[model samples]
Target: MMAKKYSNKINKIRSFALALIFVGFIIMYAGIFFRGNPIVMLIFIILGMLSLVFSMVVYFWIGLLSTRAVVVNCPNCDKPTKILGRVDMCMHCREPLTLDPELEGKEFDEDYNKKSRQTKQT
Candidate 1:
């Protein structure tokens, strides 16, 4: 059996933001090839700028999430890490952690964090 793979929520979001920046830069660079067509070039440049702005928004959201994340000492890695929800993996070791006792021994699932699930339980 293959071992389950999980990434820290904050790390995942950070990587997504980094990827977005790269994509934005690439888009802007592609605009250089369209210099002969001023309209097309302008469109490319605007699109690239929008992508970059969206990435910035995502980065800001991560900052807010970090403030709400629960910091705990990872048992597997023996390092301090933050858990964002009921199920989150250790930043250093990828070990699944949970704050809810009922989910302590259960498999990790992102759906556990959904509002609909919580409502059903109640």
Candidate 2:
């Protein structure tokens, strides 16, 4: 079986926020089709606005997480990358990296970041 592709956590969250924006805009556009029904149009508009506002909140959260992420130089690509959890991938090369020596050379698993596993790593 082929190994699963992993992406930098920050990039994943960032992309999700972007997707939310697109979805919100699409929802608002759909509201135009219901212009004859003011109540239905209003509902769609409000829901779309909520989606947009939530996306902004997610963006702000990622910004805060960025400040706390650990920065390290990727051994494979020799480029700097940020690690948000116990296990993460290099943003440039997608090399699996771990902060725990015990996990080094092991198969890359995102579950290593879970609170239950964090205690084991420590």
Against the hidden reference, what TM-scores do the models get? 0.91, 0.92
Worst 10 residues of 2 by lDDT: 113-122
| Total clashing pairs in model 2 | 0
Worst 10 residues of 1 by lDDT: 3-12
How well is each residue in 15-114 modelled by candidate 2, as lDDT tens digits?
A: 9999999999999999999999999999999999989999999999999999999999999999999999889999998999988888888999999989
Candidate 1 wrong stretches, greater than 4 Å: 1-4
lDDT (Cα) of model 1: 0.91
* Backbone collisions counted per model: 0, 0
What C-alpha RMSD separates each model from the true structure? Answer: 1.7, 1.6
- Tens-digit lDDT string for candidate 1 (56-106): 999999999999899999989899999997888999888989889988888
